[model samples]
Target: MSRSKWTNIIFLIVILLLIIPQTRLPIQVALHKLITKVNSIRVLEEDNSVRITDTNWQLKSEKGLLKNLNQSEGKVIVINFWATWCAPCIAEMPSLQSLYDAYNNKVDFLFITTDDFKKVSYFKNKNEYSFPVYQPYSQPPNVLMTKSIPRTVVINAEGEIVIDESGAVDWFSEKVQSELNKLLK
Candidate 1:
């Protein structure tokens, strides 16, 4: 074969390598970690009644129901918006699960998704994720109705939006965990 044909073959391989999921996921994750910076700051402890997290949620399974954020007042709350079809969401889920595992007892982790129950269930079971997933029984606070997927809003015990990120985040990062710990204190 000519050198041009060999070059064309190599180009096609490179394109296919980038197009395939298994080959592309790691590259995307690396790029995200390189560009996404987590800021460290103490969350305000001031009292506020904004309550954008004032929505009711039903557990994805038959486990139970979350009354409302009002009932969860005085507790550190994590409300994450994700979808089963989102690649970045899927990529970040393991870290979310790790965060859940570490703080599940101390934090109210609500993995809220607007996707259908069937799709959510399939995704959960396929991935074997232990984190609690829910569908909103009522609309979330206006601050959360975002156009982006994998949005995360961390409400300190004082009901402040301490960390409101629009894209996938490394929830188990040291800085994020420190902020969460500060909220508990």
Candidate 2:
């Protein structure tokens, strides 16, 4: 093949490679921005009077035994479904503990782990958290029909599932505090 032809082909391939990502750059940026906006806006029900039914799911407390969360009535219950392997779950744990310490008596904070009782026991011993910890039954919670990790559900005093967020969230954010405050009130 002629050198010019070869040069032209190479140039065309280079141009295509460069142009493709550039062409998609705008879409990628827009999608990223959209995701940021969506995550920033917390979706919560405006009507705060809805009450959640008693799920009666058994959860293990920090003491390494099964306990029922439904017994803690007339208080805000924050049930965090986390696993020891989840980085986000570990990162937000301190914040959850802080929140629990601030309102442990007034509100019930349950850190429900799907991990086996042995692993949970080791983790609890390694890191001492003041909040109550529990292991959900081998099955997932009724409210959270799915077995996805890092799910945080905020049940109000009336047992209504107020905030059912799946994935890592800024639990310490003003939005979360506001929601918790509203529930407390």
Q: Which one wins on TM-score?
A: 1
**Candidate 2, 1-185: lDDT as tens digits:** 99999999998876676579654444443443344334532545758434656466777665667767667677888888887766556656666766777677777777877677678767667878656667665454455565676778887777777787776555666777777887888
- lDDT per residue, candidate 1, 22-140, as tens digits? 88766665655654445222343445334444544334432545556576678899988898877678767877888999999999988888788778778889988888777777766
The per-prediction tally of clashing pairs is 0, 4
All predictions: root-mean-square deviation over Cα? 4.4, 9.2
Scored against the true structure, residue 35 in model 1 reaches a CA lDDT of 41
Model 2, runs deviating above 4 Å: 1-43, 47-50, 138-141
**Candidate 2 residue pairs that clash:** 52-159, 52-160, 60-134, 60-135
User: Which runs of model 1 end up more than 4 angstroms from their true locations?
Assistant: 1-11, 17-66
